[model samples]
Target: MILDRQLLLSNAQPITATAVSTNTIDLAIARDIGIGDNLELFIKVIAAFAGGTSVQFAFITSANADLSSATVIVQTPAIPTASLVAGSEWLRVQVPALSQAAAMQRYIGVSYTVVGTFTGGTVTAGLALDREGTAYYPSGLNSGGF
Candidate 1:
């Protein structure tokens, strides 16, 4: 999957606490982004997470660039820390289609809410043209290709 830098929401951002994404996609600036083709948001664990009971990832949109008072379009269930291994794909979902996107606000971004203490974790999130995510299997099980 090709990731465009301009569509990036978070780039290897460390998550020690609850926080908004480092960047946002301004729909006014990139009006054509999700118009013609479907785009997917990819959130990957760049570093092993430790000390957090669970974490939830939210996809939000708002009129302000700061993302305050935003509407959450979609979100992940609280993911247990035990499952947050490095290189894991936390969330991958398609961006809204043109009709839906048009009715929303102008800014899009991600939010990380950690339940309990989050001592260590790094994540990278962005919009991509393809899913291209890895499929993990239990030990001793191999599907020729994923």
Candidate 2:
């Protein structure tokens, strides 16, 4: 995939898992991003004050910058089987292309959330990958247009 890793957020503040205001992540998608490509996400846990907490990640798509009209695209299946281990914990996720559905309007992003009690976890940085993002045809073309 032709993608680049870009930082979405770097929080010195601890994330409150229950609140979207604290745990949500949003990224701006380039207008020319390819429909065949997708934006991948990563959440690297810098610290978790409490261990053994199950966390989940969710993906959302939106047309607005504030993520007001957002739709949950990839619903986190369930709380992760494993528990947080401070520096050892990291997650990777991706959003699927709209495919036959109409082209993505303007923006795309993902978030990390947990169902149960979560307190004092710091995410050093949230990174994203926009596959084939360098150009609509990031993969380049074959000779003779074949």
Candidate 3:
């Protein structure tokens, strides 16, 4: 069976998850992704503290999940000497390329830490996949010829 170009699936969305002290944010794969596919992972860190505090953002994943994962794709200096203002404060992390194993059914995880003091905060993260090449082609195509 052949697939058409329009059958290709390319989509992206935002996934937000909360982060606690020394805890990892488990991210679920929205759909089955193929190898060589590009995925962007965004991480937002919102610090909630009574006084000034510091926080570090890190990216993590599971080996058992059969997905290649890396930490600190976009390495940013630790957030320090800042007060957690009311509202959503965050940092964004983007993973340009993604690697997948032979096995299917895999997911990614994100984790963070607060170096200073904060009552609580939220860590928002998500994945975006590139599906440009996933399209199918029809056989036997004829162009304007004599």
User: Which has the greatest TM-score?
Assistant: 1
lDDT of each: 0.87, 0.50, 0.40
RMSD of each: 4.2, 9.7, 12.7
Arranged by TM-score with the best first, the candidates are 1, 2, 3
Assess the local accuracy of residue 5 in candidate 2 as a C-alpha lDDT between 0 and 100: 32
Better of 1 and 3 by TM-score: 1
In model 3, where do residues sit more than 4 Å from their true spots? 1-30, 33-38, 45-52, 64-74, 81-93, 100-107, 129-146
Question: Which residues of candidate 2, in runs, are more than 4 Å off?
Answer: 1-13, 21-39, 49-53, 80-82, 88-91, 94-105, 128-146
- Model 1 C-alpha lDDT per residue in residues 1-146, reported as the tens digit of each score: 88788889999999989988999988777356656777998899999899989989999899999999988989999999999999999779987763565557888899999999888999999899877857787999867786
Candidate 1 displacement at residue 1 in angstroms: 0.7
| Clash count of each predicted structure | 0, 0, 3
Q: Write the per-residue lDDT of candidate 2 for residues 1-146, one digit (tens) a residue.
A: 33333445445446556423233333343344344555555555677546425666555566765556666765555454255546543445564554434544444554556656655676643434533224356364665745
Clashing pairs in 3: 4-136, 5-136, 45-91
| Candidate 2: pairs in clash | none
Candidate 1 regions exceeding 4 Å error are 98-102, 133-146
Error (Å) of candidate 3 at residue 134 is 29
Q: Best candidate, lDDT-wise? A: 1
Model 1 has an lDDT value of 0.87
